[model samples]
Target: PHYYSLLAAYLECQKVGAPPEVSARLAAMTQELEARQRTALGGLGAATEPELDQFMEAYHEMLVKFREELTRPLQEAMEFMRRVSRSSARSPSRADRCAISFPLA
Candidate 1:
């Protein structure tokens, strides 16, 4: 939800020609999210033994599912980009091997 909100705000900022304001808003949102995360983590120390165990179990399950869902697509995309980069280069340079190439705007 916050990501969507931030994206919408960015689009709106572009429409309004307020790029600097978008940066400010993004920075503010990042700080707010960090603070929220810190607060939630601080509260975790107060959880009962059973609650902590349950929370850890759920978190581990979520991490496993997230990695399973994301890993393959991410690897495939990275490989595709690498292939594209190599194809575009006459000879893949040392720098190209260490860096993911992106088309310049």
Candidate 2:
């Protein structure tokens, strides 16, 4: 959907790269890829089919592996946020204090 929106914007801008037919084909492929990404965790509708169940299992395994890889960065971000909050609480005028605060519009 987002890809299609991008393609629509491109057509409106008349960038003149791909012809309409070729662009439509590419957009369809992009839509398929986007659908795959959306269902990477596999929808809950039904895994009645054998192949669908296997694919879902594989996708779940991949998600676990991805989460394992993100552990360090996730932990570091939490720690960093905690440190920033602590330092900001200690001094309101500190240069990094604004990192935790947003100005009201």
Off by over 4 Å in 1: 1-31, 37-52, 91-105
- Model 1 TM-score? 0.35
RMSD of 2: 16.2
Model 2: worst 10 consecutive residues (lDDT sum) = 7-16
Q: Which RMSD does model 1 reach against the true structure?
A: 14.5
RMSD of each: 14.5, 16.2
**Deviation in Å, model 2, residue 47 alpha carbon:** 8.4
Q: After TM-score superposition, what is the CA distance of residue 49 in candidate 1 from its true location, in Å?
A: 5.7
Q: How well is each residue in 1-105 modelled by candidate 1, as lDDT tens digits?
A: 133333333333333323577767756765676677567666655435776566666655565555456556767888999998877776667686789878999
